[model samples]
Target: MRKRGKYIIDKRMKFKRGYQRKMILKIKNDNNLTWKNLADEFDVSIQTVMNDWGREFATIPYSLGIRMIDKYLSKEKNLILSYWISEILPKKWGQFLAGELNKKKIKIPQESEGLAELIAVILGDGHLERKTLTMTGNFFEREHHKYIETLVNELFGLSAYNIKLKGSNALQTKFHSTELIDFLIKNGLVLGNKITNKARIPEWIFSKREFMLAALRGLFDTDGGIYNKQKGYKRALIEFQTHSPFIRDNTIKLLQRTGFTPSKSASNNSSIGCTLACNTRIQNQKEIHKFFNVVGSANPKNILRYKYFLKRGEIPLKDKIYKEICRIKIIRPFKRL
Candidate 1:
């Protein structure tokens, strides 16, 4: 006997009340769906749908409950409709708009150093949506884009294609296989509306030094930026910023573990989540050398900054490229203190 409550059903019902409540909520949340359509899908009368939601006496077969859950999980228009397969379906559908679900989990290359780096890159600039996985960069960051594309292919065995955003100078590499999407979701990357959900570094990735270093390299190259606060001095600051506290805290810890001392701060106001930042100054020549050798940047912008710092000992304020970065920083809220 289950507990009697708002979503509770009478013992007479075949389906649990809690399960019914979840199904009802899912239906209500989807703006395009209607109870009538759902009733038709389950081969039940519309009155049964009303009864299930309103605490009236309602009973549904176990098979119907499973189909309801599956429908809630999938997009209806994308379903593979077959006349022979009637309203009743398997617990899990064989196909969707994106592709068939690959139930087998892809082993996150736990032994490879590059795998950690790829994960970090995704955490920094990747969007793991339900139908696609994408990594984006400025149009000029061709090398960085290529690096990300190579990693995606090597790791997932799926080739990512470059897409230029309409009316924008951003370049994107997208992987559209549902199999890959499922594999990534199983490995801890959240799919769909990730900004609010906040993806973080998996604990397993932190188990090895090589993996950690590579991950940091990917993150810094994408999300981390370098700038010279002083006009003519050799001083440069490296900062990593994200709205996810999980990523922020873990990043700080990773930096500390790598023998670099860093300080963290949070923004007072941000719409999605508080902006968390960790930063450090290039204290000496040795520190700069270590950063390049151990945790090198993949982004062309950061790479250029690093090279300029090495040759000139400081980023020139008059340099057109650095000026562009600073100009964008002025306008972008992400760089705001």
Candidate 2:
């Protein structure tokens, strides 16, 4: 059963209780209007104006308040809007709007290793909608999601909200900011469907080896997987697979440029929309070790799998892998950059 609660707006957009009453009375006197007149102006019921606003029984919606200020108090509109933003809106919403109103006040970080990694993460598992940036991952990698939350906060001064998908083992971290979206687009990320846009690594990332490596780490952590090749063979394989040929080709080039020999393959199956799986793999055990040592992994699942492979010379079943990870403490918290 669903529990009843206050309206979402009432909880999200808070203001002093009697504020509506005070504003309604002032507007009535200054405009020489009756309760009916105000209700007609706002297309609301007379009871809504008199009982709700006049008797201080309910708070006015922000949109209604803005309309009142604009139509009746044009001279003080700016002042009143400022008051609404600073005093009525939630603190986080107010701060976000304030930053948007004055872009200079927003601290958009310059190019750095952290930023590069973020770009790769977005490329690997993120989606850019109209005004939101969302990244989804397996629920088993909750620790990695926490790390991404911290990384986003440290880099962009924005808080990411997590939502667990119903009926699935997936978790999503999402935030909405047009400025942030524009910043990402300016930094080479496409705004719509990435596969359609043919998204590739930003050229500037190649300018620095550290930036490239950080990006590689982000990509591998999000999209790459590691496991033993065969039940009897003591060999591990690190592989990255994507539907975007551009991304797969670029990833192979990136691995090669980073001094690792990576093999590539592709397969197409019409059963699943005929999407081609563009795959790149580093099959050499020595290179896999070097990949972990240099590029590293942010996802605890991947790290645990690699550690288990190193220790036992083979990967175990899913449940056993989970049990193994739980037995030892291996997740490294993300550090601020």
Off by over 4 Å in 1: 1-110, 269-272, 275-286, 316-319, 322-337
What local distance difference test score does each model get?
Answer: 0.60, 0.72
Q: For model 2, which pairs clash?
A: none
Give the alpha carbon lDDT tens digit for every residue of 4-96 in model 2: 111223213244555556667889999899977987787655545665457654456666677787888888777555554335655345346
lDDT of 1 by residue, 1-337 (tens): 2211112221222334354445465665664657677656655434346443423233444444446646565554233222112343222233332233334334344447777887788888887644457777777665677777777767766666786755777777877666677666665577534456666777777788877888788778777877775677787777787766667777877887887777767764454556444333444446556767777766657766766787887764324684444332211111111
- Local error of candidate 2 at residue 46 (angstroms): 43
Among the numbered candidates, top lDDT falls to: 2
* TM-score for predicted model 1 compared with the true structure: 0.61
lDDT of 2 at 65: 71
Give the lowest summed-lDDT range of ten residues in model 1.
Answer: 328-337
